[model samples]
Target: MTSDADPRFLRSREAILNAARELLLESGPTAVTHVQVAERAGVGRATVYRHWPQAEPLLVEAMATVPMPFLDKPTVPTREWLRRELTAIARQLDLDDVRAVSTTLANTALWDEDMDARRAQFAGILTTRLAAALDDAQARGEITLALASQDAAAMTIGPMYYRSTIERAPADPALIDAAVNALGTWAAG
Candidate 1:
């Protein structure tokens, strides 16, 4: 259905969305009004409001653009792979865009049904990737065959989220190592 929209119309809409995302990352939701988006997008306010009657939908869409990569297999030892993945997460969290977008998403209460669904969808994609990484580790004799892929995926993300959000601590690589080791998070199944 969306694909049936006019090419020019769709392009304009994308410009508005991109503008909104930039504003959000630069100054939070309050600063990203439709008028501001229109100005940044080089379009009219009516166009922005026509597409997004409210800013919440725009905010959610903008947030969907935030980049989040999943695990890349390390040479051997699953711990090493976990180390690299977690370290990369920590590094990404350091970016302003990541912080702005993630802060909005991490505060669960702020999510509407659409935002929640989008967030879940992205999480599912990441989990699938995590599953692949876990499968690889298991194949390489680093992870145990008995471990559930979904559980392993959760194990990989949950702590990093906790450290970055509630704990108000950096998701340092060393901290990741310690936390996983302490939990025995992925211990032989």
Candidate 2:
């Protein structure tokens, strides 16, 4: 029997995860079934079951492997920096695979406790950055936000999220500008 730490075992695990992620990105959450993953990975169904007995956990792990984009630290004015970051986020959300996996995460989280935590954790990738940026801007005396950084992150990104994930539409550029302007105004108060 191959030990867990064996190189072959690790390679197989990586293959399984890559296959599951491919299916999720290509055909959404339903395509991540053990049979599909096993077939795609060229592994036995029993192998997939051995790693993740539940499809939800399997799906979550696969989704986790999909990278969240990050921009370098701000080198421009905070508002400009925020625009660039938000624009990057909008562009990311515009991808078909991103929209599929994101919706899958949100919908699945409604029913699965583990998935819910994962969803929040995944979402923090953006919000945490947003919060940090806002805090940094405040420290620089560039803007004063009455709301907490976390709340501000949500407020700014919520529209983009809704457009891409909920409405199944691209995030409009105008919406991005509007969000930035609105946040700036809110922070100015």
Candidate 3:
């Protein structure tokens, strides 16, 4: 049995995830069977199964590798910070392959509780970060609305997600800018 401490074992596990991601994108989640991933990765079925007992978790791990924008430690207020954060998110979401993978995971996660939790956890991370930015913005008088920080964060992010998942459209920079500007306008009211 390959232990977690084994470097070769770690490489095999990464290979499995990479293969699974590529297959998931090419053929969707239903086609990402252990044997298929193993063959694509040039590893054994046992190795793939040993690392990821279930396909959902395997895909969740693969989706986790999708790059999110890196936010700097906020020394500034929320509205300004949120603008920067959203700009970064917009750029990341503009990548066609990244958008496809995200949409696939979102579709799969709806029916799978494990995948749902993974998606929720990922969203929570961004929410918390955005909330902090919002709070700082409020303190600096950058926002005058009485909305909760979390709600404000959601308002800023929800549209992008809606367009990407529901509309199945690429995130347009102009649209993102308009959304961010609209949020700023609402908060200033």
lDDT tens readout by residue for model 3, 37-89? 99999998988888977665676676566543444476554545556777676
The global C-alpha lDDT for each of the candidates, from Candidate 1 onward, is 0.69, 0.78, 0.69
- Candidate 1 lDDT, 39-128, residue by residue in tens: 999999988988888665677688678654456434556666667777777766665445555666545425567667777877777777
User: Each candidate's TM vs. the true structure?
Assistant: 0.62, 0.67, 0.61
- The backbone clash count of each candidate, in order, is 0, 0, 3
TM-score of model 2 vs. true structure: 0.67
**Residue 89, model 2: Cα distance from true site in angstroms:** 1.7
- How far residue 76's Cα lies from its native spot in candidate 2, in Å, is 2.7
The top-ranked prediction according to lDDT is: 2
- Model 3 CA deviation exceeding 4 Å by range: 1-11, 14-59, 63-72, 75-80, 168-174, 184-189
Error of 1 at 105 (Å): 2.7
| Cand. 1 Cα-lDDT | 0.69
- Candidate 2 global CA lDDT score: 0.78
Best by TM-score: 2
